[model samples]
Target: MEGMALNQLFGNAYFGRKVLVTGHTGFKGSWLCLWLTSLGAHVTGLALAPNTEPAHWSLLGLDEVHDLRVDLRDGQAMRQALQEVQPELVFHLAAQPLVRRSYRESLLTFDTNVLGLVHLLEAIRETPSVHAVVNATTDKVYAEQVIKNGYPEDHPLGGHDPYSTSKACAELVSDCYRKSFFFDGGPRTATARAGNVIGGGDWSEDRLVPDLVRAASTGSILQLRNPAAIRPWQHVLEPLSGYLRLGQALLAGEPVEGAWNFGPASDATLPVHALVSQIQAQWPGLRSEYLPGPHPHEAGVLQLNCAKAARELAWRPVWSAEDTIRHTIDWYRAYYASSRLLSSEDLQDYVAAAHNAGLEWAA
Candidate 1:
């Protein structure tokens, strides 16, 4: 998928569109920015400066993006940025995204994840240029039921940790704004709940793939707190495709304003140890050591049923667990061996895979 074919994705809804992306400095946000720009969307990124050294946003060197370093918690700043951008499409991905860090900085997590979203939505309510909005949440928004079949879109929203609870609150905030303000003829709003997203360029703290990369690059033994924890994992592009498809639906005046899950197939769900083993198989130097200790409360098992996305959006993950691990390891291997970026290549490969799978968006 390239050139005309790439632009044809999502019915070419993104082409020539003015798009606003919050948290564009973060991992997933950077990837979304790259993909949106590739589809010919004029992107304006609104978020704080990149917090980490060697940030993906800087590495991508996307000079065309109108980058604005504005804090989401600042309502005035959010309003000013939205007013200036007057974006036709919006993707909100900013938040305190870590569970353990949330326990340490619970107040900051709530203020950023919950209140930050309020600021964005309030701004969107006032700025009429925005025709569609997708608020990216997490799979942990569902209460811990440990269900084998996986949590559906209607699963009761609850969270044991601050990060999860705050995202759940964000989901509620989106719903409130949608009904209270945008119910009649306003920006079509929806929420996206994605599972554990692993790919290149995600060097965020406390995440599994990044931690493994750190240990492997430094030749240190990786620590595993909950090796048996099961999570529905997929490449970063999987849920992003779902989000883009959902946005396409909204932009086309289709009725897709609601919560949707973007996760891998049931067979791809695996334990932390299993994922670690797969990564180790790909990179022989990677090693791990299980640690026995009292750790922060994290979900032991979580899965998502993406039937709604499949039925309505015609979205399904194109990569399997093996493909995900292999591509992830290959990416880090290329980056560490030489200063190289595989993001664009990976995106093209993913689009091609989706095209091969007969996905409508790729078609």
Candidate 2:
């Protein structure tokens, strides 16, 4: 989509608006910053420096973004950053995102995911310029269950590990702040629970796609744990679209201050082994070996019902699971083989596809 056409998206809420995206140095956060800037939004990013060497944030070279290396645990610093930027819209994505790492750094995960959100909300409360906030949680927030369909928004919030538990706690924190503080005269807020997001530029440790990329690039056998585990998988752009749509509603003063699920269709929820096979089909010569026990606890099967987003927000996933995997693998291949960045190309293709699908936000 062109600049004017992209600006017309989400009812022009983002065009020329001052937006704050926490965790802008991370994989998903960098994508969000790129999209927001494409829509002509003035973006201020607040988060710690990128931990990875080939960090996507640095690769993008988004000079327009006001990148501030502020740790979310510091309440005073967060408050000061908010006061300085005075963004009208906020998307909170900063957190200790790894599940396995959370086991070793339980306290750090809790501090960053739970208390970090508290600090941001407190800062939002103090900063009067903010109007709408989208707190990005994860699908693991739902308690373990044996339901066949999928977990809805009303499912009980619970977690088995520190990372999941911290996010669930963050959900609760968002609720407490939304109801307790963001009332009659306060900024509107909502929580977004999305499925397992896979895309290029996500070189995070212990994740499936990055692991596959590393193994494939190094000509090593990929180790697999919980091969039967299933998750609601979608491209990174899928949930970012949902977040932007939700932000559009909140900015429009719509009554959408509650939790919502942004996930793929039911059939897209595939097991770990099956997803691996699909990716191997796209890229030949990818070998793997299943690792036995001694692995940390992870959800076996998890899915999400996005009926609420479709019915109310008129939002839906533009690409199918096959499309998502293909785009993701192609991106990594281009990056490694020829040092080409397909992020901008992927964004344009995704927007065109969404517009073709008649999604409300894209239209």
Model 2 C-alpha lDDT per residue in residues 1-363, reported as the tens digit of each score: 765678788888899999999999999999999999999999999999998879889999999999999999999999999999999999999999999999999999999999999999999999999999999999999999967779989999999999999999999999999889999788999999999999989899999999999998899999998889999899999999999999999988888999999998666799999999999999888999999988889888899989999999999998998999999999999999998999999999999999999998888
TM-score of each: 0.99, 0.99
lDDT, residue 84, model 1:
94
* Residue 77 lDDT, candidate 1, scale 0-100: 90
**Residue range 1-363, candidate 1, lDDT tens digits:** 776567778888899999999999999999999999899899999888988877889999999999999998999999999999999999999888999999999999999999999999989988989899999999999988977678999989999999999999999999999999999999999999999999998888899999999999999999999999999989999999999999999999998999999999666799999999989989888889999989999999999988899898889999999989888889888988997999999999999999999999998
Looking at candidate 2, the ten consecutive residues that score lowest on lDDT are 1-10
Candidate no. 1 TM-score: 0.99
Candidate 2, superposed: residue stretches over 4 Å from native: none
